[model samples]
Target: MTAEVPTTPPGDAAATREASERGGLPGAVDPPAGGGEAHAASDSALARVVREESGRIVAALTASLGNLDLAEESVAEAVEEALREWRVRGIPPRPGAWLTQAARHNALDRMRRDRRYREKLALLAGATVPTAGEVDERLPLIFGCCHPALSPDAQLALTLRAVCGLTTAQIARATLASATAVGQRIVRAKRKIGAAGIPIRIPEGDDRADRLDLVLTVVSVMYSEAHLVAGRDAAADRDLADDALWLSGVVAAALPREAEAHGLHALLLFHRAREGARAVDGELVLLGDQDRGRWDAALLSEAHRTLESAARLRRSGRWQLHAAIAACHADASSSAATDWLQVLTLYDMLLRYDRSPVVRLNRAVALAAVEGPVEALAEVDSLESALAGYHLWHAVRAHLLRLLGRDAEATAADLRALDLTDNQAERRLIVARLAR
Candidate 1:
């Protein structure tokens, strides 16, 4: 959903400037090499549940035990155990419940030795297994992690680790920081959260107001990461798009009065509506070429209604503007029917909230649609210094150059994009472009 038209960028150590400019999301891990390693990580239900449910399991444990580190550590232990046990025994009927129970037991075992966590163990006793009545605390965990007491980088790192289950190395690569720095950020963040006695629950009143955008940003980053990984079908270890949609919906429901929350939901839905049509038989389908009929009409209708609801609140934010832009594309009868002018205007407004080159690069796409490739080329070229390492930047540049009949330059740009991209689908598309 991200980076195809303008598409999402994959961040790494080389992405120093753009990493800060874009949200911190690592490139997808390449598929495992062979045999048991592949089966454990990919070819099993154990892998699916761990990918989808680990964050919520960790969040629920953190809420029950009131210890972030222990909850996360215990969940990790439970997953390791699952990797070993689930293969021999097969997946349990209720994987989340099973995981929650296993993680709780792991926590109790660890806490029994700690002695200091006796109170926590005592508190954990009543809810040993997950029940239907047990509330999902992932939304709360997300808000609590984004608390303003932590620095912005620390906040991003902590949320990605706790809520998204990203490794410190992955977060560091995306943020262009050392693994040590990311480790320090997470350590200090946990300490600050514990010292300040931050509750494992959603903030209320003005506190929610201050952190809502940050929370949505974190959620969007999660979806972006999911979208990127989903594109790499060979390495598709997790189908996090459903989880991301559910989390965004939960956050939006939890804070109904917040326009941006609904806006974020609408933005995601607009993308989801067309997701099924994104690829066909292992080849990436460009937006223009994809069958419009394949887009989910129900989801598109709901996204419009949601966007309209957001408008009625009269509280405009960047997310709302983004939804409006997405709406423009969704409403078009065909790619040629897309309202590039209104889309460009929305990007204009988006600049007020974020002037990052990623946004500018996306805006250049609309610029090409409305003003022709020459103007868009200049715009894309301006962002070269900041986004040279990002594959989509060159991909977009190649598109514009090819449009302007600069074949040699376009070939060179496509080759550069091929070098930078790790996603198999995008790489194939670039290879196709070069062949043309």
Candidate 2:
């Protein structure tokens, strides 16, 4: 189950806030106070803290415990302890370090209680607790949890749990699955890793390349979720985007020769540059309506530089092509100025590498931009069977039909999209479109 914010009113936000404050699970934090400015700032700060420290904590714990499931359980327990103790004692000067130490103690205690765990305890007994500066040493554990032997779903679950420090429920909300479903997936994945005796160490050379795709996939998923709340939600969410970027940088730094890593980093940077222009006065702003002048010129320049590096590597990957397409849009000052034809070409190239419904839905948008709504409608139509439950597919079709003057059909499609989506903000936007 992906973690998600509950859909209740602000009054219930307090309960959520307490749950998060206690840290028994990932994403149990309280809702931000104040509806407008104060809430946004608080949320942003919280998100930043999570993104920065979660991976380090998870990495350190996993290394110490030598079992993903045990490590996670211990970490969650430590966080819960912190919530209770910190409330009266006050937060430690280094919260991450405190949590890490607490979790390590918890793990050690658990091992001491179980005779079967004695062997693992012996290995960990002499190991020094990790400091903030030593967090990078756990990179191997990050790769191990995201290994390719695991299914994509398993990889995502393990990464969120072991790498991103998210609770199963949070992951459930993020993936639009049930908490039970997500929990089971995490359990099964952990069991598989343990039973398979998958070594918790990074591979070298060709073996590393085999796992690269899985690693990239995890980073991309994190970035996508981060982008969803990039600017619209509290500042805390913005930290999620930053966290994803930081982790991608870690991957890139470790594998500088990997073209796709550079490409993914560039793509995220380009998309992030538009965060400031994505919303106005608490309302969502479509890309077409956003003010180009508000875009981050510095970030845009950095994206271009990364794109150049990816190209110079002489390897063509999905991320490289997608970043190239984003660059096309970024180069344009306005929607009308965009190179739709070039964007369409890039989408076609992306289609060859990725068959994701989301990718197909995006390609349909580019098709509409360059070839008119009718052609785009054709593309959307072809995806109908495959994307029956996807909100964006219907939303795009609704827009295309509206442009084609099919009001009734457009309204039906819009309603369908609205029914399929659970995100309150996204739902409101679709409802408004249908009302129009």
Best by lDDT: 1
RMSD (Cα, Å) for all candidates, in order, is 5.8, 6.0
Q: Give per-residue CA lDDT, model 1, range 5-67, as digits (tens).
A: 432333211121122123221222333465455444322565456556667777777888777
Off by over 4 Å in 1: 1-43, 128-135, 167-184, 234-238
lDDT of each: 0.75, 0.68
Candidate 1 lDDT score relative to the true structure: 0.75
Cα RMSD for predicted model 2: 6.0
TM-score of 2: 0.85
Per-residue alpha-carbon lDDT of model 2 for 1-436, expressed as tens digits? 0011111101011112224434422343454354334433434333333446556755665676667777766766765665555544555677767766787788889889989889888677666656655535556776788776787777777776677655565566456566788778877888988778666777899888777766776676666665333113322255556777877777777788999889988988887887787655555567777798888999999999988988999989788888898899799988888898998899798878886666777877888877788887887899888767656667778888988999999889888877866555666677667666
lDDT of 2 at 287: 76
Residue 207, model 2, lDDT = 80
Estimated TM-score for each candidate: 0.86, 0.85
Can you tell me which runs of candidate 2 are displaced by over 4 Å?
1-51, 129-138, 169-179, 229-236
